[model samples]
Target: MKYTHTMPFGAAVHDNGVRFTFWAPDTALIALERNGLAAAPMTRDADGWHRLDVPDARAGDRYQFRLPDGHLVPDPASRSNPDDVHAASEVVDPQAYDWKDAEWRGRPWTEAVIYELHIGTFTPEGTFVAAQRRLADLVALGITVIEILPVADFPGARGWGYDGVLLFAPTAPYGTPDELKALVDAAHGLGLMVLMDVVYNHFGPEGNYLHAGSPSFFNAAHQTPWGSAINYDGDSSRTVRDFFVHNALYWVEEFRCDGLRMDAVHAIRDDSSPDIVEEICAALRDGPGRERQIHIVLENDANGAHYLERGADGRPLTATAQWNDDLHHAAHVLVTGDTDGYYADYADDPVAQFGLALAQGFVYQGQASVFRDGEHRGEKSDQLPLAAFVSFLQTHDQVGNRAFGDRIDALADPAPLRAAYACLLLSPHAPMLFMGEEYAASTPFLYFCDFGPELAAAVSDGRRAEFGKFAAFGDEAARARIPDPNAASTFEASKLKWEEREQSPHREFMAHIAQLLAIRHRALVPRLAGQPRGGRHWRDGEALRVEWPLANGATLQLLAHFGTQKASGIRQLAGQAIYTDGITTDLNDTLSMAPGSVCITLQEDNTHG
Candidate 1:
């Protein structure tokens, strides 16, 4: 039998039926204020867990927590349903959803070219089924996986999925439970892996109801910019951690998802003996003896390698992958040269950006950061494989955080932007792209949400005023102009024009991305398959060269030019121009590199021959 952690017991949903549970360690009496059903008294267990089995409770149920004083609210441990965000939770029959990916094992992190996208804005329709229609486009572009932004139920049909309140439900605005399954099935049919991003940091301020029942799911010990930190190591913390771990496993097993990207793990604080992260990792590593390889990525700026390291038992724990923010910062600072905000720390050091991102994981390793005020340390990545870092030129936070909801195109020259693109994809690390970035879509990805009047005002006025206080990050005066969540235009401005791919410049850029992806797949993928571990080499700023040397004489050099200015040198490869980017193939012997192009070929002519 598989070992299960005993939670403080807020709520339980098994295959048979849901045993409504709660850990009110401090409560004298707890009642259930269920929606669509009559209120009932819950029986308290000796361990402070309240239990009331509802056999008739099938899928599509909406419920919440009720206090003894007649105070009614949503469930603190709601698998779904909070503030009517995405509708009520359903008792989904996991077995009913047929998965066609039975032959679809999994893709290694090293070989993955993840495309991070928000479902709502990915297409004109902005629905799960609508997004599924584009699966062929991603597959044709040589993308192996789609890392979706947080899809857990959040308030309204708009907004970034981060402020999710319902921990266990997929966002209803996207689609129904069956529709999500269909989307996953469609992706698998195209040989694409699907990764769902999940947030366990802190509940959004609008629909948080843990205070109504088990109020200890938060800690006053430390604070984060969003809200109070999660109760990872606080009183009755075991249950809180269990709640999240179960949610994570449910997505993997129940949804049959290929992987999960844990959002903002840095916000989780745990000084306990057996760390919450460790516990979660162990649960994932169960079943088959490590060959299954269900990927679990983390988004942390801590620059710690141990987070992805294995335990003494040979079980991987830290994370399979993480967002390489340093790479983004370096690339952004060099190409755009925007010397405001947090980027102030990275101005005038583009080569440093390239070198650090090449040799180590982050450029801010062990350096005194003026923005941070203290010396920040990063893990030594010399022995680590390059795939440990997942890089991108643009992401939701990097673009949406701007006061005006601007993208890189707003401030960067197209030529240099192309150069940055080559640098990102051709680098040793795994590369990711935001939606519509390949064709240089002009629409801005803004921050929008639908909340109650008071919360909406607090978010628009208060959040904007607070973020604007960081004059070091951007123009303080323009902060007031940040897109308001209440405005319909905010959501409309973020949608992608699906038809633009057929246009002139957009078509050309799209072709460039497709060519780049092919080269990476043909030249770089095999090296990882043989070596499993990744490798790289550094070159002058004029040209960045990465060599992945394998067991045999098999080796590959991912060559890319950094500057947008036309570059030419006589000696690199005399006759082969089979795979090239940003450069025109005049003939077999001569090559003219456009601003942001790259070439992938055998390290030596003899290898190809």
Candidate 2:
């Protein structure tokens, strides 16, 4: 089957010829330059858009726009940039690739066990084809969804995709657009849903030519950490908003992606009634979402829960769910006892907060955050479904943002970390794993990027300097020990050593996780839809208790003791034991949960009988 999203922007290939659409509202003069050949003058309409109808132009042709200043710039809406961001844009026929997963309707959000990965660091080849070859491995690990880091074309040979500058085109460093499509097709055939990460908050520091053509794309009044926030609500912002809305659609329809996970949405500054996020979700729900399950998750640090509100029909009003940073933060504090930056917010009694997260979604829930200087954070999330929050022990931000990018395995004891893993995966919340987490790989997921010499040095120096507040990196010599992000070795060090899975400790951990996922798929997954909201979580000191009512009139119970010693006076839980880790015993009608242990049981509601 064939799929194509018809957007007003970008080059559209017709049977007769190609029709080019360029939106440079501020520019008066422009022309189309194809294949480094003679330039063809374009006609500018009243809205500052230029159009060029070329009868001979066809797919696979390279093109760029010539500004009035005599400078050439690639199209912002390019489908594929084979050469790189600074080079020519390739005209791609989205309908050319024949999709084999035409019948892939997609799995429900309740079934999501997200496995987030960076394409460049996921496999040795760091290409789409290599990643495709590893799809069955993820499926074998029981990952229902694969969330890819942003693939939008960015400058340089290697980097985390968050720095992507091109909003539409897939990076050339990965395979061609067709190869990417094949990967998505292969994933769907394996019952895996692929989700792309998109950044609409701010463009990268390099290779953004919109200012040279469409100067109004950035709003000067609102600033972000990356720079000026995107012009989402200012004057001439309709076209800017359309650019991103169509981007979401293009990925789902043209690329046949299952959905998107918008990066750092809290950084986006949009003041309109129906915000950009809402508009994007509405577009999807009205468009392709009507047919298949197309999810829109978010990485909003602000902890906004309103966006995850469901309609009267129990369908998501806007976003499907958001990354539950609160859960990760609490788990980190509880396991590693690391109180730095945002982790400081969860330092005091993190076990209670962790329980709240497992039972009631986000723990903050409109509470004052100490790390935010007494500022209130998050909305009430107790009423939301457990699956509305994507839970994880680690993410790109959780690990990569660190000074050394140490995984949780390197931070805490093996027993506590094992218990934490059980807490994360066995919970009703949608769980996600950073690449290679299932195997307990020893590699660190460091922050690495390749930029020009000037920007590269600045980024490297700034990266080392940012950890100055930490006592470990207070000295200049100590700070210098941090790996340089621009170094090729740094990027190579972040790649997963796939063969490590056959080793002793790694193989043992992999088997444990596989067993947990097997039980989850057999017991929890089929009954997830019955859970309308989060469960009840309470804790007495380090001993935590959580319970959820499932569809079969069974109460799923979890008893965990995070203390260094055994905890007594625990009420005995009745039901079939689903899984157990560590030493848990029952004596004289009382339960004694050993230190760093977790127990899962199901109590069927058959007392009346």
Candidate 3:
């Protein structure tokens, strides 16, 4: 089987020829420049689209567009740009590659144990082919989904891929477009689903020539952290909205991606009804989702509970789930005790906050956030199912954006981190791990990027300045110790030392995780299909308690102690103890929870039996 996502714009190959189309409403004259053929003038329509037809164009042919002023730019919807984002685009026949996993419809959202990874650093080779070799390991580790960082072509040799300019093209440094498809196909063949991370919030500051060609692509009325906001609801914004919506479809349909995890959607300021996000989700739901379980997850800081609404059948109406920052922030405070920045909100009572997250999804449901200057954040999330929130101890942003780029294992005690991991994987919520979290790999996921000299120094200096807010980096000398973002060593230092996984603590952690996942699949996942909601939670001294009602009339309870001192009066509840990690009970049936220990019990409804 072969797949190709035909788009309205860009180079589309047909029997007649390759029809090269460009959206340049601002420019009046346009030309197509190929390797062998002379620059041919393109006919412009009233809507600002330029079109040209070449009968001899074939796959692997390099072509670029020439503006009225003779400036050349790569296609915005390019499928592959071998040279880079700034160079010519290679005409790709997506159907050229035979897809192996045609029968892979995708796993249900409830079965998701997402492992978010960066293609550039997932393996030693940092290419699609190299990353494909590691899928069997993840499958053995019980990961259902592999969420890769943005592969859309961004400028420079190294990047996080969030600043991508060409939204449709796969980055050249990571290998060819067919190689990416192969990676996805290999993952599906291994019974694992692949999810691509897409950024619609803002294009990278550099190598984006949309403003030069399509000046109306942005709205000046609204400003974002990264310049003007994308023109989703403004005048001439229809095409802009279509561009992103099509990009989402392209990944799922053409690349055969299981789903897409949209990055920082809160930054996408749109005022239209059924806004850009809704439109994209609707398109996915009606498009590829009609045949398969194509999921859409969001990293929305806005805490938009409405977007996570489920239908009568308990499937998502729009987004499948959201990255639960509330859960991470609460757990981070309990683990690291660093109550600075946004962690300050959870610092007051992290255990309670963590309990709230476990029971009700969001802790700050319409409550005043001290970190946000007394502003009320989040909506009522008690009604949402536990699976609607994707919980994790570490993510790329949580780890990489830190001053030292320390993993949870590095900052907190092994016992606490282990307890957190148990809580993360054992719960009803979907759990995600950073690339190396399974084995607790030793390398730091530092924020590294390669920009031109003009922006390189400013970016390096700004990275240092951002850390100045922390008390540890009080002085310039301390701040200077922070790695340079643009340095080659910084990117190299961030790669996972795979050899360390076979070492002492890492191997133990990996075994522990595998055990937890085994229990989760055996005990919990079977109960998730009936729609389980987060239950009640309360604090008993230093012990945090939470109970969730499962779909099969089972009450799943968790008793965890995060304090340095041992927590007493953790009553041994009337249930079958499924998992006990460093938790003990006295002879008198009085329970004692050691610091950084967890105990999980399940009470089946015997009343009906």
| Candidate 1 deviant stretches above 4 angstroms | 1-18, 33-37, 82-90, 287-291, 310-317, 466-480, 530-554, 558-560, 563-601, 604-609
543: Cα error in model 1, Å: 4.4
Where model 3 places Cα greater than 4 Å from the true spot, the runs are 607-609
How are the candidates ranked when ordered by TM-score, highest leading?
Answer: 3, 2, 1
Which tens-of-lDDT digit does each residue in 360-396 have in candidate 2?
8888888898999999998898888788899999888
Query: Per-residue lDDT of 1-609 in model 3, one digit per residue for the tens?
Result: 988888898999999779999998888898999984789999999999899889988988999998878888999989988988889999998878998887888888789899999989898888999999989999998999999999999988898999999999999999998999999999999989888999999999888999988889999999999899999989999999998988999999999999999999888999999999999999999999999989888998879899998888788888989999999999998888889899999998788888899888888778898989999888888888989998999999999998768888889876777888888888999999999999988899999998989899999999899889888998999999999988988888888878877899889889999999989888888878866566789977778888898876878889888888877766776688889987777887888888888989888887745
Question: Tens digit of lDDT per residue, candidate 1, span 54-124?
Answer: 76665556666567776666555454452365233444444446676666667666679999999999988
- Every model's TM-score: 0.88, 0.98, 0.98
lDDT of each structure? Answer: 0.71, 0.89, 0.89
The TM-score measured for candidate 2 stands at 0.98
In candidate 2, stretches whose alpha carbon ends up further than 4 angstroms from where it belongs are: 540-542, 584-586, 606-609
Reference-based lDDT, residue 378, model 3: 84
lDDT of 1 at 359: 49
Which ten-residue region of model 3 has the weakest summed lDDT? 526-535
